[model samples]
Target: MASLLPYGDVDFSLRAMAGRAEGFGRNAIGGLHGPLYFVTTLADDGPGSLRAGCRRKEPLWIVFEVSGTIHLSSYLSVSSYKTIDGRGQSIKLTGKGLRLKECEHIIVCNLQFEGGRGHDVDGIQIKPNSRHIWIDRCSLRDYDDGLIDITRQSTDITVSRCYFAQHDKTMLIGADPSHIGDRCIRVTIHHCFFDGTRQRQPRLRFGKVHLYNNYTRNWGIYAVCASVESQIYSQCNIYEAGIKKKTFEFYTEKAADKAEQKSGTIISEGDMFLNGAQPCLQTQHTEGCNMFHPSEYYPIWTMEPPSHSFKDVLQICAGWQSVCRPAEISTNLD
Candidate 1:
């Protein structure tokens, strides 16, 4: 029928975008007070290059106008108050990856990461104490460790409008349960596409997470997981399971030393599942333990009514919105 004719794409595709007002990672602005800098060369490291500019350790807007695969020889260590905007071109990062350690207020958007391999490489690694980050409209595949890894007390992050495919260990919020420092990790993952990933659409630990409005197709093993004191709140997402009947939405794994212990918590609301996907809620912890609740962190968001069904919203708005491309906005910091 006419209803099936890429209706979702017509409404939500990148071609429909006009500006950045509806961008999902809209709040993640790093250094709007500074001047805008563009990546002029494909050189990974040089006097005036991405690697050199990021090491300046000052507040600035970084944009890329050229398109090429930059094979990083070392993990690009980003400084504080930097925004790497790849919106206007097709930039690909391969061979190596980016690292954010103890940084603040960074924004990464509209790029592609593939064919990366090296010592503990990831598409983007949010290291300890990193905060106020926004990653959106990116594509990632075949990373050595994870597509994205937020660990070591990283907080106030939002990952949105990204396409993740052809990978294993898609995302990880917390590295180890016993690393009590990870208790401070809090992230929001919204409107992303988990396509053909094997596992860990995000295996969590020792953090508070909120997942909303995502579209998942062809999950290899499982969809969402919570492990070791992690509190995950999933809302209004769509999941299409793979061939295995065990392609579930929620799962719990035994922590390293606590094999018999109940792991984390999963609280979901209004999620859609198809193709024999059924996930049982599992939060069998001991009595009187202080577990985090979803409502306390984020307010419930409502979608506009009629004309668009839940399936349509997932297909159209989940990965990338071309019509409303991401733009830099200034804050009231003056």
Candidate 2:
């Protein structure tokens, strides 16, 4: 029995009502008959901020419409059907962080999350039993673990068209292998870019993952690390100068076996150059993995901005752009 609060009609700024709403429940902000609780990120031209008081079973719709940045130092958890829409604006969540636990039909879109100099600060964390979650068109930077992490029975989740940079890990799905079978999770990652220059390569363990048309550049380690029993079906993916193509070199033996089961084309060279020199892998143990290189003759293509499948579903249009240098291009590794 969760209460419903529609923010589509309210007009309260998150900055103006920060202290007043701290510890305020649904009855205080929205009143008993209030249809919604509106929260904005603009506060006296300073850092627009909002802090949700401890809540038990309330459904909230929070909108981040601030001009500058917003820091959420405390935990804000909502019930089923709650929505947080950033409207493609720049709203940052810093400090303690946001927790969406046991929530269903949740939507978090078009925002930025910056975890401060704290440890274990995650941009958006989906706790166990949180189902039907949608995180789209968000940009996240500077976190301890990753921009977004889904674990513990979090099923039917969608993370699309997001950009992640300057984090220890980019994106993660499922907890440690010891926690397997405690959750049934399915994740779809599309059209996202991972820049792992600061950290080791990004890893995704456990669950069934569908990774399509993602671009990774300048990462220290591998692109993705799928678990032993995990089913990772990736297609039309591009990885540039990462440690390994799909698995870290340490897990080569296990990753090779998994790559054999889930088949697809992995383009290790730059997308701007896809010529006959490009290597395609049908299995994990195939030789000549390093002989091929991506060419700069391929055409440049742009997909719809917010759609993760835009690159995979859309067709290429114009000529290729020579962005990478020849010497840099020659050093393409899997």
* Candidate 2 structure quality by residue, lDDT tens digits, 127-167: 87877666655777887665677777776665655677777
Model 2: residues with Cα > 4 Å off, grouped in runs: 1-36, 40-50, 53-58, 197-202, 242-334
Give the TM-scores of the predictions, in the order they appear: 0.82, 0.61
Against the true structure, whose TM-score is highest?
A: 1
Give each prediction's root-mean-square deviation over alpha carbons.
5.3, 15.1
The TM-score of predicted model 2 comes to 0.61
**Global local distance difference test of model 2:** 0.47
Model 1 clashing residue pairs (backbone)? 14-321, 14-322, 14-323, 16-323, 17-322, 17-323, 17-324, 18-323
Q: What lDDT tens digits, residue by residue, belong to model 1 across residues 212-255?
A: 67777777778887787777777767777878444334334545
Which runs in model 1 stand beyond 4 Å of their true positions?
1-27, 247-260, 283-291, 300-334
